[model samples]
Target: MDPARSSSPNPATLAPLDLHASWARSREFGLRPDDALSDALVSPADLRDRLEANARLLTFSRPVIENLFRQIGCPSSTLLLTDCDGLILSAIGDTGFLDRATRVALCPGAEWSEAAMGTNAIGTALTTRKAVAVEGSQHYLTRNRFLTCVATPIFSPTGGIAGILDISTDARANLSHADALLRTTAECIEHRLIENLGEGFLSLHFHTRPDLLGSPLEGLVLFDEAGRLLASNRAARALLQLHGEFPQGSYPECFTTQWRHLVAWAAFGPLTPFPLRTLHGQTCIARAELLLPRAPHGRRQAKSDEAPGRAEAPPAPDTDPRLGHAGTLVAEWHRNRCAGPLLLCGETGTGKRHLLYQHCRDHGIGMPLLELDGRSLAARAQAGRDELEDALRQTENGLLYLTDVDLLPAEARSRLFEAAGSSHRIVAASRHPLAREAEGNGLDQATLARHGAHIVTLPPLRERTDFAHLVHRFVREACPGRPIRVLPEAIDRLRRYPWPGNISELASRLRLMLALVGDDSTELRPDDIPDELLETAV
Candidate 1:
């Protein structure tokens, strides 16, 4: 519901009644419009107590507040987070802005509630329990008319206002974009607060589209061991049409998917998406994360692969020399851990996609991986459906991976760069380095310059030192439960061939060799190798 309509006003009604009410409240506080502003700060001891009381909010909100300030990039703008009472707990901005704001008591330790600060954005939002903007003369106090502020209340788990996130700037500054960003940022913070309540809760992350699974816009629902709804965020409430009654229902009342199936999926991992349908028939793609309590320390230690009671043998070591270096490059560009997009380049069958997945899994990067075939994206764009932009809206915290990016049409390439910008962490794969492709008129020069900041090139299979290891591993997987011994001469004969088709060709030939194996034969000989592979001997 819109805040302005909270008083049950008609859609066409309104002469700024919310503001008028705020003005009335200010007058009731005995604050004169022409009165001099107070520049006093709360005592140091009191400030310390407030900070300690809201430590969790600060821990989760600090990074978001800092990032918001960076995005504003205005020397006259300041970002602040305050408790429910409007006591400022954290403040960040340009040095010049901070100095100016401190004089108006807009810094940390100052109270900005409506009772003390008149009709200001932070104060008004808290009183109305909604997002609001107070600009220029809208402020009841004459002293505050020089500032423009937009604020939104952050809700706690129990459905009360936890705090307010506000952006204050010069009255002359335009805030058209700030309002939207502030709301989204507050939601992101609220989601984090709910996630922190993990013990004995089963958290469900879902959306109508699979590509949107890990994004901030995804609906989050928390359930207890008995499958009772314990808490939910704004997105969840809207998606489920809870109508203001949440945290009292059970899982069976909400979802048609059995509770046991959800538990089974959670025990495996949150990587795969399952079909989740509500009783109302809204189909959703969802992932479940089971947050069961940890076992005793000794029991937990025994479950580790390195523990003394390990039953299965450890896997063989990788012989690929390029994999480790590529992993470091990937970590450097991961959005949650670092910054920027990663451009992966390699020959066909050189395992570019494999490397991408391996690095993400090894590092425990849990964000959803939304892979888009560049050719398909371009095709859709030419058909007039702006698919790239649609995907961008659903990929706030996802890994957007584009495969065969070199195949994109010229117009689609431009659209990609413009639509993606810096709002997402994109990983694009191409058959060759983007710069080289640009020189051949297959890519945009500016696109190469932007995405080429960090590039990881994969070596062809023939050039890899791990050829033998990969062959053994692939063969083992291809013919499981029926082990075929590979002779030394057969291995040498295979290495003699120049593998222009790389790893993919090798696996194909191995599958064919396995097909020719007789029921009585356990050995793989050189004579069983395909004729074409031998004909291409170096």
Candidate 2:
């Protein structure tokens, strides 16, 4: 037996407060108990608009509804999605409920607002902005009294009702579990809705239990680059003790953690959950999902004002100012150079390879950087063996950089371990911590323990505190030998734009800016910035 279907609410269990209010509102709409439901529906074109408007809701809800129907397996019930206005947008049901649904105009494009269907699930839930169940005889419309409908409102990222997810069944059928199911399904849809609110948003997921970090129960809060609280889901609002409306403020106003720290921690990905506490003294484990703004089109190709073949000076041993704590961490790694096998962990474009180059350059480790890819090694046995053996021998007095090490096959891993035990200085990199990958891949922990001891995580560009410094440095590099000044306004815009592509993306944009200028001694202004980048800023 399915746990979700284990219990049913008594027919009279729907609270009277909601019904009494709904009934009064229905009477006020001049809806008499005996009046028949009007044969009204949203027109085809209007329905299309509503469908497009609720596309995200539909996209995320369909799978959940299908799964719910399979779990319920009741021929007397139907599942529906409706816009905030109570117009049914989508519906699915069993053969037994199909005829009943059609007769009552409960199918797609049908209007079910309180004005049309009086004191019903979708309409009352919309009006009250709450979950509701209208059982037999509780419906204001005498025609609707033979059916039971439970509905929960799906809220938009901005906290307004986006749509409704409802389960409608024959009044005689027992569906006590429908209410819980609808709420849960609605939560899932709402969670995805907030998380995917595109570029330049930092989505933070948190829960009291570390294990619930990815589930619907987790609290989701979205912040703009300036750290303003853009939107939050139901769980977030509840977790933060937000009342009627989301308070107007920044992210730090609600949480104890600084915006920069959250951004940096999020770059490490979901494998690591950091502690986050609310201003109200509530603490939970949290992870951040960073969505950086992207260019609308391919990068502009233009010649720089500076001459070609300008050999840049090697970076000083101090650190890459763009990295902030990640830079410090890399510096620390270099300080303990040759301590053990090095593990560099972070999201892509986070400068894992860049750090390795810096480690050799700053520390003056003359060993050549020999590379072997784990995927290639895992894919071709003979070629990989030949490549690995060659790289190991060449880097015996140098360095061996192994990328995507988490993807290495067991055999490939054994060879690499043997090489690590040799004189070769080995550095392995992955998007996640090697230990976590070991557990996920069902690899032996003891094997990973040896190579994973010294791990350094590079923060994603969006999280780095030295964003402005990076912009200045890249801009200077782009227009080397020319007096180039980035206006404060342009710098502010660049800082607020989430650099999704990180260091490489930032450098590319700077080059584009110089290309666009096409002149010597240029002053970069806000207009010189990419329109896409500026548009994505808060």
Candidate 3:
């Protein structure tokens, strides 16, 4: 139910005579009209609103609100947040005006409800289900005759108007951006509505042009086919209006105008797919599909030529020559039970990071990889609860690769593991055996063991028969669109070298040699090798 529905629908019913007189009997009671009325009816805690939410309501017209006022180029800004019954909950503004307004019980609780106050910005906006700017002299109340107040109704998860957000300045001060600022207020309220709703469908809208992103006319619309309104936020209503009437099944248009093109396009394009912007007559008819929010199966690693015999295997993984064999590992791991995480052990040049990223492309996992240095993760965590909660939200169950966990400070080792516990995949890599450091840092032996599952050690270049394959591969790429080959003697020298930095070092050296050699067809020889490689190997 919307907050409005939760409370009385009307505020015209004046406070009970017994309770109204009770405030006159005491100073404390006199100072607080709210306490007097609520107490006579029930109590504060009975309302279930927290003190902080109430406090924020008091300063509703702070600099942030003023900045909004400035954005519209208005001279003064006054804000009022009302209870569901149209009774003022809180009012903020220039001190003098607000103080004066409140004394007349005009601040709150006197009930300037639409029923009592009649058609006005705050009341008419809610009553008509749209933003309203009542300029001076438009007010039904003679007292409100000199003011111009632009008000927009904010909604709850249900389409019901929850409160009114109004910016009241002098009528002469209104600017071109006034309408936009009113819509923005409505949009902000809807965001808070969604956050409260937790999860479900959310629709965003902009009044000026939905295609023109970042316009001030931005707004949001929220609903759940599941609930009544599910947050027909301001944006949703605008979008609905802009699109004309919603299709039969759609709920009420709450706060936006974005559906016209979507409905028009889907209706006209029954066969071949067409562009959404294509217009026929005044109506647009086309198909525009966003990337699917949920893919049925895990993302595949390779997207290349499929194996000839593999029956249902989706496409092969991506092949940037930079990610050769390890890229294959990333793909295969996704297809097979990566039931446990993979602990990749390799030197810097071994392309470990590239391999880890391939898992992101292929896995059905909802979370993308969330990387953090072990030291930073550890330091950021204050207590286990605070740290664990933040990590869980950020990681979203995806891979948490603690790169160079060995380099993490001794004090942080425990907290890092504690934070990693929240993620589904906790893949940690250290060039050295991290097991020994775990003991020194007092890391739980069980946690460290858990992270060590499926360790795949990358071999040094000298030990890899793949080195020759890599050399050949690099040569082919270097001379792409043409033909070039590595010299037999140079390959022999490469095989002989210790190759301390491994494949990455070799790839770099080859790229430099390729650049130096230009388009020459001559096979590379020892003389063509870098002096440093020769000095080290000779």
TM-score of each: 0.66, 0.55, 0.37
lDDT of each: 0.72, 0.71, 0.48
Q: Candidate 2 — which residues are off by over 4 angstroms?
A: 1-14, 268-270, 294-538
TM-score of 1: 0.66
Residue 340 shift from truth in candidate 2, angstroms: 39
Better of 2 and 3 by TM-score: 2
> What's the C-alpha lDDT at position 528 in model 3?
78
Which portions of model 3 miss their true places by more than 4 Å? 1-341, 362-366, 374-392, 418-423, 434-447, 450-452
Ranking by TM-score: 1, 2, 3
lDDT of 2 by residue, 246-316 (tens): 44567878899888877765544433457899988999988775554433432222223344454233233
Best by TM-score: 1
Give me the overall lDDT of model 1. Answer: 0.72
Q: Candidate 3's C-alpha lDDT? A: 0.48
